[model samples]
Every structure is written in structure tokens, then in C-alpha cells.
Target chain A: MGKRSARLENEMIEYLPRMRRFARSLSRDAADADDLVQLTVERALTRLDQWQDGTRLDSWMYRIMKNAWIDETRRRQRQGRHLAPPEAGESVGAEDPDFDKRIRAMSVERAMATLPDDQRIAVGLVLVEGLSYKEASNVLDVPMGTLTSRLARGRKALEAQLNPDSVEAGHDD
Target chain B: MMIDDETLIAFLDGELDEAEMERIAVAIDADPALTDRLERLQLSDQAVRETYQPIAEEAVPDHLIAAVRQADRDTAPDSETVLPFQRPTGDRPSRPAWQAYGAIAASLVIGVLIGSRFGLTEPAPLHFEGDRLLAGGVLATALDRQAAGAVGEGDTHVQLSFATDAGGYCRAFQQGGTAGLACREDGRWVVELTAPVPAGSNGPIRTASTALPTILLEAVDARIAGETLDAEAEAAAIENGWSGDPD
Candidate 1:
């Protein structure tokens, strides 16, 4: 580890909670989620010179987590580590009913797994995390329209998972 | 009243300005379908956020806190910009940037240094055995007996002999109106390159015989570890079988 300012380091620590939340929202596995966080922190620390002091640290952190997740996902795909697919998320919860937190985490992971990487991240950043569309798009490095479209698609997918009946009822509007 | 989903989303997320929000609000008020669509998007988001609440509220796993606090083990900040291609100073002996291209043909006869001083005459057909030049024929005879300053048979002259930074010996010479650089490898001379010999060439890289082509001069500059072998050193190299002894 090279020497970074204590201020930057402390600020990064302050933001770890939401960073982990965003990481979990992107990655399906807890271990992988934490791994993404670890990778992002390491990257951000190593590249602290790139960060401006007054800018939103959360925004910068989110972008790093996003890029790190993409790299991690590609590596995992290359390594054939695609973790038994989304179907496993549903069944694993049923089999391990005693762990409530595990069940809740798995259920969220299950809902998240319904969307592709792009849409899921859009939803995670905008709808769930309450980033303004502009900020979310900035984090995503996408235009506002692209971010909204992905978020809409991601919401529709999660809506289906949440209220299967509403989707079946054909909320055509 | 038929707003696209992205526009509707921007409206629902309050990303629109007051005017656009007002317009969408009026449109939604008049259209139950729009209202329902907005409701669904909002409800889905609410439900997802609720599901995620526990994760955010859950105690940051001790492991994660430890990871965040473990700054000493984390990157210091410049490592991320370190170029991916500039690998650490490593043993990069992988067929280097030093590309020497030429061929030793079995029958493509070379206009050898017809050296009378070395008792050599006429051209020789030098061939490659496994890409290593077999110092055969008149050229080999000139090189083996008197590789130093042996301008024996014609205007051809062995201008200089020097050991390379790569621990190999190279000889620069002009023959048959062509200049060439040959470096010793595996006990045999490999004609690294040969170009049409230039006349009166004084390149910035060196001030040797102007007749020495710039290619040969540059080749010597690129390879010579220290200095070209003096006459005594060249004689000693001949005595040592030119065994890459770095004389």
C-alpha cells in the first residue's frame, strides 16, 4: 500500500456501508460482493490522486465498484464460476430456512438476478440508492436516457419478481 | 398522455424540471393508465428498497470493516495507473525487440572478401544449419584465419569486430558492393543483416569509414557493449576461436 492522505482514507471508510450495499446490489454472492468492495477500495486508494477533494466520494466509489464488478464478472465468467444460476438462489433459501438474514439476502439476490447486469446496476444506483438520475448516470457513465431506460426495464423485471400477479395481469400501460 | 417509459421514469423519479413535472402531473391526472403505470414503477422500487433495507442496516460484516480499516494492506494510490504492459523489470528474454532478419542460403553465393592476405579467393555459398550461419567458403576462410582488417581479395574490408551487449560478437564489413552486420551465435556467425553497401557514408551514430554503410554503423552502435575490439583484441579473439570470449 502506498501512502494516501488520512483524510481520503477516513472518508472512504465512512462510505463503506453504502458501497457494500451497492456492491451487494450488483453482485449476487456475499463473498463476491465483499470482494468487489475490496477491489474497489484498493483501486480507489491506489488512484486517490485522481479524486478531487470536494467531489462526492460516494459517486467516485460507486464508479470504481461498478468497474471492478464488471472486471470481476468477466473473470468469473471466463473461469466458469457462474454460481449455479438464479434458480439456485430460490432453492437455496428454501433449503436453509433457519437463517433469516441469509434468506432475506438470498431473496434480494434472487430478485437482482432476474435482471441482466446493466439493468440491475441501473436499478441499484437510481431507484434503490436514490441517486439523482444525473448522478446515477454519471456513476454508470451513461447518458440520462440510457440510465432511465435500463432502470425502467430493471424495475419491470423486479416488479415481475415481486408481484408476479401484476405482471400476469399485464400492466400494459 | 402517452409518455414513454423512460420519460415516465424520469417524471416519477422527479428528475424533470418544474414545467415537465407539471406537464406529466397534469397528463397523469387525466390518464388512469399513466397513474397505474407510475404506481407500479414506484411500488416495485419501494418493495426492492424494503428488501435491501436489511442489507444496508445489517451490521457491516466485521470482515468488511476490517477490510476498510486495513489501509496498510490496500493500495496507496499510484498502483492503479501503473501501465499494464510495462511489466516489472523481468527476465524478458522472449525473442526481443532486437529483430535481425536475413538468411544463409545453401547456394545463394556471397561475394566474399576475396582476401589474398588470408589466402582466400572467390565467392562462397554459405548456408544456414538450423538458422546458424556456418562460416564456410571464402568468407569463413577470411573470418577464421584473419577476421581483423582482412581486405584480402578485393576492395572488401572487415571494418570492425566487437562483442555485443548481448554477449555475442559481431563483425561489420563491406563485400561485393554490400555492407553487412554479422553477430556470432552458437559458435557460428549469423549474418544479422546485409544492405547495399553505401559510399562515403558519415552517419551521426559514428564517424568510421564513410564507405561503411549506416546500417552497419547503427548495428555496431546498437550492439557494442563498450568499444570495438582493438587490433590486439581482435588477434586474441582469432586465437581464442572467436568463442564469444568478449575480447
Candidate 2:
């Protein structure tokens, strides 16, 4: 946390909530999401020097979160902790657990979990997190074109999982 | 233009230009089924966002922040020169990045494994250009030109260099201040590996002043094609006409 990346630091702090949301969506568990967020922050802080001034802060943060999520998942799998849900609650509104919110959130997490790591991350960044194509691209350190393609495919795949009927409907249209 | 998912998504995110968004909006209006499908996409996005929104808003716990800050403090010492391949010693478990790579390899031929990670591969070995060249310049030159015997008790030293069978090269050299290595092929010398060779063992990492480390040497070996060079061989090879690819 050098004082030099002051703007970046401020941006990072401001965006922590969004980053946490993105991480939570990926990890699905409070503890794991927290760990992922911490790792992302640590990495961002350490490598603050690598970030260019012109780039969007959210994209860079997303990339860090995505990488951290991948690493954490790999570590968990290596430790044979795959089956246990990473998060304690099933839904985002787990604290509430009322019917509509609970049902939607649980289904979303379940569908999200079924996705391959890359696809899930792309969807999480672009759709769930509402990152701009350019912003998500910078975070992934992928070319903008690559990010767009990934987002397109990821969303399509997610739709197939969450609402297979929609795919058929999509084809019919 | 035909509607693509990227275009649709850009529309969904409110990122499309007015024309693109308007075009999609017209299409959605024209087809009831398309409107339904787009609505589902939007709802799903809302659902996911709603689910994770709490986590986002919740304050970052002090413990997590504290742990990260501690890791920063712990690693700050070696942040600048932490090589990618050096292993951790018993004394320092929280090794820097390079030492962590080396520590991971300590179980086996850490050196060779470390070499390949930095792209000093067997067939298509990595060559140093701008930053890499500056990063490992003198040490690479010393490794190519000097022999162990010629290494002085002074601040710089040449430890090793060899041309592998595959036509790539690897070297381990040291600034008397820092023990490290440099390897060359096709006129480009990439510092693939480095470590503090003890002055006794060459005064190990603490004594080595140069930035290149032994972990990078492992990277070099992982990619080299044939055996490395001894002093005499390097001299002879340099004297003969040289080209980027080994003949």
C-alpha cells in the first residue's frame, strides 16, 4: 500500500463491496469469499506498481478476484474439499431465507456452481457484477475482443443451465 | 446487423451505443418471445446481483485486512528481488515469490523445474529482450565468459554456463555481491534462474548482490536441449561462427 498508488487505493477501498459481491458469487461461501477477497486485495496491493493509470480500476480488481478465486478453488480441490459448499448459506439473502429471495438465490448459486470455472467467472464478471466489456477485459488482462467472446459464450452457457427452455426458445426465435 | 450475444449483453448492461441499443430495443418490441428471453437474462442478472449484494456491502472484517497487511509486511523485505523459483529455507517459511518456487522444488530437482517455469524451454527457449536483459545483463555475460576458477573473491563471479543438446543455453553467474546465473542462446541471454550461492557454498542468497537467482537456473535447465558449457567449451563455441539457432 504505497502512497504512490493513492488513487488506486481509494478506488480499491470504494469498490470493496462490489469486489466482495463478485468474490462471494464465485466462492459461494462467506469464509472462502472473504479469503478470496483478501487474497485479491493483497495481490493488488503488492502489485499496485503493475497497474497502469489509464486503465479502469474495476477491471483490474476483477482480474485479481478471478485469479484468486481460481487459485482458491484449486487449493480446495487439492485439499479434497470440493463437495462441501464453500459458503454457509445457500442464497445471497441467506440471512433472510424468505421464499422468493431464497429460492432464486439458491437456484442461482446451484446453477452457478455447475458452470466451469472460466465460464462462471466470465458470467460473474460481466453479467452478475455488471462490469463493462472493457472493464472486465482489463481485469482478466485479456484483449477486449476475447473478453466479449468469453462473456457471450459464458452467458449462453449459463442460460442453458439456468433455463434450458430459454435456449430452445432462443432457437425458435 | 444480426443480433449477437455481445451486442445483446452490451444492451443489457446499458453499454451499447444509442444506435445498437435502439436496434435491439426495436427487435425486442417486434418479437414478444425475444422480449421474454431478454427479460429472463435481465432477471437472472438481477437475481445474482441481489444474492451477492450483501457480501459486497458488509464491512471488510478487520481480521482479513490485518492478515493481508501482515503478509505485506512479512514479504516487504524481499519484494524487490524475490525470484520466482528459489525454495524456502527452514528458517523462513514465508519465502518471497522466487524462494517459494524454489522451496516447492526442494523436494526434488528444484533447479531444473524452476528453469522451465520462466519459459527457458527445451525447444523454444526464452530470450531476454528489454527489461529481462537489463535485469540480468552483467551476470549473464559473466556466466557466458568466465569460469569458476576465474571468479574472484571480489564482488562478482561466473558460476556456470552450458549449451544444452537441444540448442538452447543456460548459465549461473554471480555478482560478487549477489550469487546468480545467466544463460544465452541466439545472442539473447535470459536470466532463467538465480539464487544466492554461498561464498562458502558461494555465500548463498544473502551474500549474492546480483539480482539473478538459482531458481531461474532451474528454469534454464528445464528448457535447455543439451549439456551446458564448461569454460573451455564456451570459449571454443564463441570463437566459431555463431548463429541464433545451433547447427
Candidate 3:
């Protein structure tokens, strides 16, 4: 491997943890998210020339993951698979059957999983991944205004889901 | 200037330009309602952030790591790269990834942070000294010894090591499903706060250094002064006994 490729690979390794977090938020499934992350890694490694040297590698990788996820979601739909309802997302931590009794503090993540994919990705990229609005917009291929609106909607949805009694119409312009 | 939810949220996310940020900061200081709105938004933002953050600490699946390592070797016919494989059940991934490294870290990992047993289990890596709770056992050893991202023989992995503006260092650490931040002071690792890391935040994930619980993150944000150390800086800090530069 060339020295540049090796350095980039190391950077890619550092970013895997965060990329997985973004994938889970987008896919709303752990196993599915890992698939998305792996796909992104493979794509990014081969397309190293396409990634601009001065640009943020993480952002480039995120865009790849987002595109891969869209492709996967479409493929799943074509196979007659549909998204499950929000109630089904309670199994987000599905690996642990005892999740209810074990992790009471997970209401936040549960609420997040209930969001629509666009809103969830907006929230994940900006809030969870700590991407700036401009960076997140580029990653999602949306305008900054679009990103903010989705984020506001995602935040409101999460508020209602997490604290239904305290819901308010505070998100409207 | 009218501050809509988008503008306020933009300010909250640090996306506003300096002038806009200053304007919002002043308005927040002057208007209780604005401050309340911002705080409420911040609460939800922090919660959402903390929820997904634990995923970063979970061991990156081996296949994913393998993909990255083998990126330069793409000339080889690695058909498995294109195929999805069942998660290795033999790894018993439910436990935090600490066990994958060695027995010492596995042994010193958290017992139980859930329910009423929080912070009360035996082999707890922390205890109180006077009014200050300090790192007692392996957590202390890890904080004292491990550089950032180096999961050594210590029970804890120091995921991040950064200096505060006050010339002291703080580290974000994880011991199994337990994660917290401790800053160096008085030659001791003072525990600012510790919280139960959601065991299933991501793929029933655990181990490695973690993103702190919201409260600990708030504390770190308030104190870190925007000086998170890079690897070289972290190594130098460790060589200097986890203290920030004298200057």
C-alpha cells in the first residue's frame, strides 16, 4: 500500500465507531446498520480517488453510507419488505430480550428509532454525529434550510414520543 | 431580529456565524423565555446525542474492521467483502468489547449499573475521599497510565484524553456498561460524575472508551474549553503524567 492509502485507512479505522452510530440511526437496526457501514467502507476504499483530499473523510464516508442505505431500502422494498411500525422498533435493542427490564434509560434512543428515515438521518448527522449544518447538508445532499427543517421536525417528534404529556407546538416558524 | 425555531436551533447547534451567535447569546442572557426555550431544546438534543453515542464505543464488528484493513489489498478476490455474513455468535457480543482484548480489563469491567445497585457493587473502581469522589482501583490505574485509545492492561480504556484551559487533563473512560469522565486534580483523578451506560445503546454494545452520559458530557463541555488532544498531544500529556503543558 502507498503511504497515503495507509494513512487514509488508519483514519477510516478511527471513524468506524462513529459511522456505525450514524448507520444505526439511519437504518434503525443494528445488524442492518453494520451492513451499511461495511458497504460504505468497501466503496470508500475503492473510490479513494473520488474523495477530495482536502474534504472531510468522515463526511465523504457518511454520504456513501447514506447512499448505500437508500439503495438497500429500495432493494428491500422491491423484495416486498416494508418498514415495520414504530411499536416494532421497541425491539431496536432486540438482541437483548430482557431489554425492557435492563435498560430503562433508553427511552431517548427508542423515540429516535420511531422517526421517519429522513428526519432520523437529519437528527443523527447533526446532533449525534456532531456534524455542522453545512457538513450534514452536504452529507445528506440537502440544502441547509432543508436540513434545519427536518431537524426541527425530528426534535419535535422525539419530544412528543419521549414526553407525550409535555408536547407543544413549539417547532413551527 | 426575529428568532424562529430554526434560528434558535441553529444557534444551539453552533451553526450560526459569530455575529448571529453573539446576538443569540445576548438575547438568551436577557430573555428568560428564550433561555428556557434553548434549554428545553438542549435537553432533547443532549438525550438524542447520548443515546446514539454509546455505539461508538462498541467494538466495531471484525468484518467492518477487516474491510478497512484490506482496502489496499482490493486486487485480491475477496468475495466475502460483497456478501453479508451472520454476526459471529461465538463472539458473545453482548458483553462490552473489553473482554476481546484480555482478562484484566474483562475482570475489572462494571458489575451492574442498572436499578438500585448503581455504583454500589463490589470491585467498584471508585470511592469517596473527603467530599471528593476519586478513582480508587483499576479506573485510577487506567487514568494514571493509559494514553488515549490505548487499551492497556488497565481495567478501563481511556477513550479520550484532553487538556482543560486550566492546565489539567480530563479523560473519558468506560468499564463495561459504565462510562464517566474524570479530570486530573491535586494529583488524583477526581470523578466528576458517573452514569449507567445503556447496555444496549447500539448492538448491545460495550467496551472501549465511551461517549459520556449527558451530564458528564455537559461537565466536560463546560470545562474542556475546546482543547481535545490529538494522539501525539495525548502521548505527550501521558508522558507528563496527564498534566497539560505548563504554559
Model 2 Cα lDDT, one tens digit per residue, B87-107: 235554322333432332232
DockQ of 1: 0.16
- Residues B1-247 of candidate 3 have per-residue lDDT tens digits of 4578888888887888999999999988998877867777887776677667668878887678667755444432332232211123454344444322233234454322322233444344666689887776567767877765555433356656666888788888765555678888877888886665544423433334232344555566667755467768877777777654332
True-structure lDDT of candidate 2: 0.57
lDDT of 1 by residue, B112-154 (tens): 3222433334434355678555545555645655554444433
Give lDDT tens digits, candidate 2, residues A1-173.
23221123335656777877888768666677777778887887678667776666667778877877777778878998883364545556777747877877777787777677877787788777877777777667778777777777666655655565675434321
Name model 3 segments beyond 4 Å from true: A1-4, A84-106, A167-173, B29-32, B76-247
Tell me, by DockQ, which candidate is best: 3
Better of 1 and 2 by lDDT: 1
Report lDDT (Cα) of residue A87, candidate 1.
53
Q: Pick the winner on lDDT between candidates 2 and 3.
A: 3
Question: Compared with the true structure, what per-residue lDDT tens digits does model 1 show for residues A32-122?
Answer: 7778888888777667678776788889889988888878778879998884365554322234446764555565567787578899889
Off by over 4 Å in 1: A1-3, A83-108, A167-173, B72-247
TM-scores of the candidates are 0.52, 0.52, 0.53
Best by TM-score: 3
A166: Cα error in model 2, Å: 3.9
